[model samples]
Target: MTKFGKIIRRLQGDESGAALVEVAITIPLVLLLSAGVFEFSNVLNTRLLLEAGVEDAARYMARCSGDWDTCKGFAQNLAANGAVSSGSARVAGWLPGTVEITKISKDATDTATGVQLYLSTKATVDVVDVSTDYTYQDLGFMSYLGFSNFTLSVSHQERVIGW
Candidate 1:
């Protein structure tokens, strides 16, 4: 047999490195998938926690009949506490620094007798808007994919139910 033919036969029979090559190609893909799953889960959890905090603050403000400054302080405190309770250690500073409270006077309407009556003629209804901005920092693996930080803004509004 010619030397070239022998070399071709040897190359055709070589299967020893196939598994290694396959593993080398698939390992990186699997790792990337795992990292993506982890990062996504983290982001989802953070969002849920933020939602819970905002909801808590809104509910508190809605039920509070206190002065504007007192109500704002209460809402801020409640939101900070809620964040801590939600298992996010980084939310403490973020809440106070980013929390925004706005109060608006709105006309109340009553429709108990098949007719709309303006209740604000007697007393005004106050609505409180609470909003906060948060930054989510990628733990580690996601940083490798050029994801470092993301901004999340959450807000909730509720009317004061005081009579």
Candidate 2:
């Protein structure tokens, strides 16, 4: 036999659960990677949902003029049921059962921020402030890793009369 054949035979003779070793080394790595993907997907989905919620809330607030309860109830309903993955809890936690409208400028001023809208919505939530865990729990497999909380917050303004 050739030298290569002899080396191959020698290696084969030293069989010592190489497959198990490879799997042992690789299983955790794969799980960790997959867990990260799952976590990111969860965050991305929730972020999308939140963005949608923001749009809906802003739109609804722009269209309607209520004391406070009316707008918050509308926001909760829109954020919760609108997305493919419901965000009722997140919205509620973010804005709380009762949303306090900090400001409602009819003629909004233009700034370097972004938009100048006739309607601006701002609500402070004093629920638990544990969005990270909340969304982490919402995740599928990442929950097994005990990642069940995070921080999520944003301010949005849209034009009222324009669009």
Candidate 3:
């Protein structure tokens, strides 16, 4: 037989299960890649939550620095408040069921005429609470793959408006 003929015969006589074997080996790798995507998305979600919570707390504190009760309430509202109520609302679902807002200080900056009170707030997020109550549709894949919740802390300082 010619060289071309021999090559054609070799190709036709290839093992029947070659494709099946390749697929089997690749399946696990595909699944792992998908899992990694899910995990990375979860991490991004966590970061966004941390950012939003910090912004809310800071804005609230900056707005009302003179009144202690109002400021704490505002800070608490920021810490957990409706921050979880708006936007993606996905990560918000993971927002700690109960968040604590601690005041870093209560002092005014600048002169008496145009005083800007500086206040700091911190929020402690509970991972367990997130798992139990988070509503991220049917996104249980990552959580199943050991993407459990963890405490996230956020801090910010804001200048209170008015004297």
Candidate 4:
């Protein structure tokens, strides 16, 4: 055999670097999987927190008797900080301005039958929808993976009871 071919065969038969090669391949994959798990858990936790805040705000607004502007403002505060007034945000990087409060009024009567559309027999039903999108901040994992930051959105809807 040629000198280079003989050297190649000898190196391939050697097992000295086998464990090193395996470890070199395994460690990075393990780290990547671990990082993915951590990031997914973090995102899930943030989404749950945001959902709770949105539900609270939507429920509060549904039962609120205040005017439109003030109620929306308080709802924003509640969603972001879990309080009507100023407080710390529930999630990091979450701001009150990120919350969007929308009010939707559905016709109470069915157009075809001219009867109440809702089971509650109301002429009009109001719904409060609270929504927000949060930008997740990873520990440079996504950037290392050549990906941009991802956003998570949460929303809650409640029917106005006027109670």
TM-score on alpha carbons, each prediction = 0.75, 0.54, 0.53, 0.78
Q: Pick the candidate with the highest TM-score.
A: 4
Regarding TM-score, does 1 or 2 come out ahead? 1
- When sorted by TM-score, best at the front, the candidate numbers are 4, 1, 2, 3
Give Cα distance to truth, residue 102, candidate 2, Å: 4.7
Q: Candidate 1 versus the native: TM-score?
A: 0.75
Tell me which of candidates 1 and 2 scores higher on lDDT.
1
- Per-candidate clashes come to 0, 6, 1, 1
Report the lDDT of model 3 for residue 33. Answer: 90
Error of 4 at 76 (Å): 1.0
lDDT of 4 by residue, 11-98 (tens): 9978898999999999999999999888778778888999999999999899899898888899889888989998888998899889
**lDDT of prediction 2:** 0.52
Give the alpha-carbon lDDT of every model.
Answer: 0.73, 0.52, 0.53, 0.87
- The TM-score that candidate 2 achieves is 0.54
- Model 4's alpha-carbon lDDT is 0.87
lDDT of residue 62 for candidate 3:
54
Instruction: Sort by lDDT, best first.
Output: 4, 1, 3, 2
**Candidate 1 whole-model C-alpha lDDT, 0 to 1:** 0.73
lDDT by residue for model 1 (104-124), tens: 775565545544333455455
